[model samples]
Target chain A: MAARHTRNIVDRPIWKSKGEASTVSFSAFAFLFSELIQYSQTKVKSTAELENRLEVAGGEIGRRLLELLTYREKAPKRKTRLLDLLKFVHTTVWPYMFGKTADSLEQANAADDEYMISDVNLALTKYISVPRDMGSFNPGALAAGIVKGILDAAGFPARVSTHYVDVPGLSKPQTTILMKFEPSVMQREARLEPRAT
Target chain B: MALIYSLYIINKSGGLIFHKDFAPISRVDLNDSLRLASIWHSLNAISVQLSPVPSCTGIELLEAETFNLHSFQSVTGTKFVLVVDPRASSVPAFLQRVYQLYTDYVLKNPFYEVEMPIRCELFDAHIEAAVQKYPMMS
Candidate 1:
C-alpha cells in the first residue's frame, strides 16, 4: 500500500522565531531525570558505576549544548582560553541548564591545574534519595561530566569529579565539581601567556 | 517555492546512519545510498585538502538541474545532507536544527550505540513532525 502523500513536510524552520523563549517545566525534567537515575541503577553493580553512566549521559548533553549555545551567540565566537571557557560555563552554561548560575567558581590553592564550581543544591539530585547502603553515590557526577565535556570540546583536556561539601550554616549539602587540567593544557597556557616586560 | 525532499545523516567513517524521505520519489536502494555516502565522504576530504584556508568546512550546497542538496558537517565529523527545492534559502538553519535533534534523540537514546544505524522512534517522530510543517512545491 502507498503511504499517504502529505504536503509541506519540510518547508518550515526548526526553531521558533522568538529565541530563548522556549522552556520545559522543571517538574517534568526532574521526573525524567529521576527515572534515568533509577534505570542506570538497575544496570550497574556499584554506585560508582551508576554514577559513571549518569556522568557519560550528562557529558553527551554538555557537548551538544556547548555547540548550540555558541552557534546561537555568534557575535563573539566561543571562548578559547582556559579561564574564559570556565567562566563561560559558570556564568552562561550553568544558568541555561539549571535556571541559575553556579554559587561559586574557585581555583584550588594547592594545585595550579585545579578549578571548582560549587552549587548549594544540585538540581538533578535534589529530589533523588539514595539508599543508605549505597556508598559515595553522588548524582552530581553528571554535572561534573558536563563540565568536563564542555572543557574538553573547547580543547582543554581535564578530569572532573563531583564532591559533597558541608558548610556550617547551610541546610542543604553543597556540591562541588573539581576539574583538574592535564599537563599539556597547562603547558599550552604557559606558552600563550604574555611575558612580563 | 521551497521544499525539502529528503535528508541523509552520514557518520565520520562514511557510514549512512540515517535517511528519511519527505516527498514521494523513486525509492533509493539501500546499497546505492551507502555507496553515495562513502563517495561523498571522500570528495569532502579532497575538497578540504584543496581549500585555501586551514580548515575546509566541507560542501554546503550542490545545485542540480531539478533540485539542490545542502550539507553541514559538525565538529565531531557527522554530516547532515538535505535535498531540497532549488530556491530553498533556509538550508543552513534547517541543517542546524537537524543536528540538534540528532544530538538529543539519537545520541541521548540509551539504547542507541554510537555510529550504528539509527533506530530511535522518538527521533523519527520528531523529524516527521518537523518536516510536516513545510509546504511541498507544486
Candidate 2:
C-alpha cells in the first residue's frame, strides 16, 4: 500500500510543502488583485457587498496564513494571551505579509478590549484607487478581515475596522485598524490571569 | 528541442491577469488577448465536464503540428498556460517554477493589487532569463 501511494505524485498536504519566505513581482500581484476587485464588483449588488466579498476572500487567506506562519515559526508553544497574540501579529505576521513591520500598536484606554494596529502604508491598498462617490469603499476592508480572521483563530473573537490617518511628513496616508474583542474574550482573560499568579 | 513562446495566466473569473511573450511572436491586440483568455477559461471548464471520470482534472496539454500548449491550475482556480515548441518535455517543471515565482514575488509584493495586469519587473526579469536559458530558445 505504501509503495502504491508513493508511486503516485501530488498527494501531499499543503503544510507538508516547503515554508521558505520568498517574494514575487509587485505588478503580478497588482494585476491579480485588480481582477479580484473587478470580479467582486460584477457579482455584488452594492459597495458594501463588494467589500464583504473582498473581506471574505481575505479572511480565507488569513486563516490559512495563520496556520502557515505558526507552523513556520516552529515555536515550542502557541500564544494564548491577548497581548502576546496581538504582538505576534504586529511584529511577525505583519512583516511576513507586508514585507515590513507595522508602524504602531496602541491600547485604547477607554475600553478594556480595544486595540489598534497602524501601518504607515498599508500594503494591500498601497496602489488601489477608490472612486470619489464610493466614500465608504476602502480596499483595507480586506486587511481588516484578515486581522479578524487571525484573531478569531487565536480564540479572541474581534471586530476590525480600518481608517486612514495622514501624518505630516509621510507621502502616503497611514492606515489604522481598530480591533474590538468580544466581551467574553476579556472575561476569559480576567479569569485566566489569576490562576497563573 | 523545445522553446517557449508565450505565457498567459487566467483568473478564476475568466480574466487575464498576466501575459508575456518569451520569444517574439506576433503581438496580440489587448482586446483579442482578453477574448482568448476567456475562451480558454470556458474551454477548461467544459473539458472537465466532458471528462469520463468525475474526478478528472481539467485539460493539461494540447498538441499541434508546430507548437504545444501546457496548463496547470492552482487550488484557487488560477490557470497558468504556456505555449511551447511541441517537443517540450519539461513543461510541468517550468510551470512549477513560474508558479513559485508568482507566489514569491507577485503574491508577496506589498504594492500588488490582486487581479490587475501584472507589471512587476522582478517577475519579468526572472521569467525572461529562464525562458532564454531553455535549450532551443538560448
What lDDT, from 0 to 1, does candidate 1 have?
0.80
Q: Which stretches of candidate 1 lie over 4 Å from their true place?
A: A1-19, B1-138
lDDT of 1 by residue, B1-138 (tens): 338888999999999999888877776889999998888888888888889988678788889998898889998999999998887667788888888878766665444567888886658877887787665556
Tens-digit per-residue lDDT, B1-138, candidate 2: 238888999988989999987766677888998999999999999999999888777989999998899999998898999998877769999999889888766765444566777776557767787777777843
Residue-wise lDDT of candidate 1 within A1-197, one digit each (tens)?
Answer: 12222334366333334344435786677657766876887799987888789889988988987886676553659676888888889987887788888999999999999999999887766545444476667778889888888988888989899988888898566899999999999999999899999
Candidate 1 chain B: worst 10 consecutive residues by lDDT? B104-113
> Residue B92 deviation, candidate 2, in Å?
40
Which sections of candidate 2 miss by over 4 Å? A1-20, A194-197, B1-138
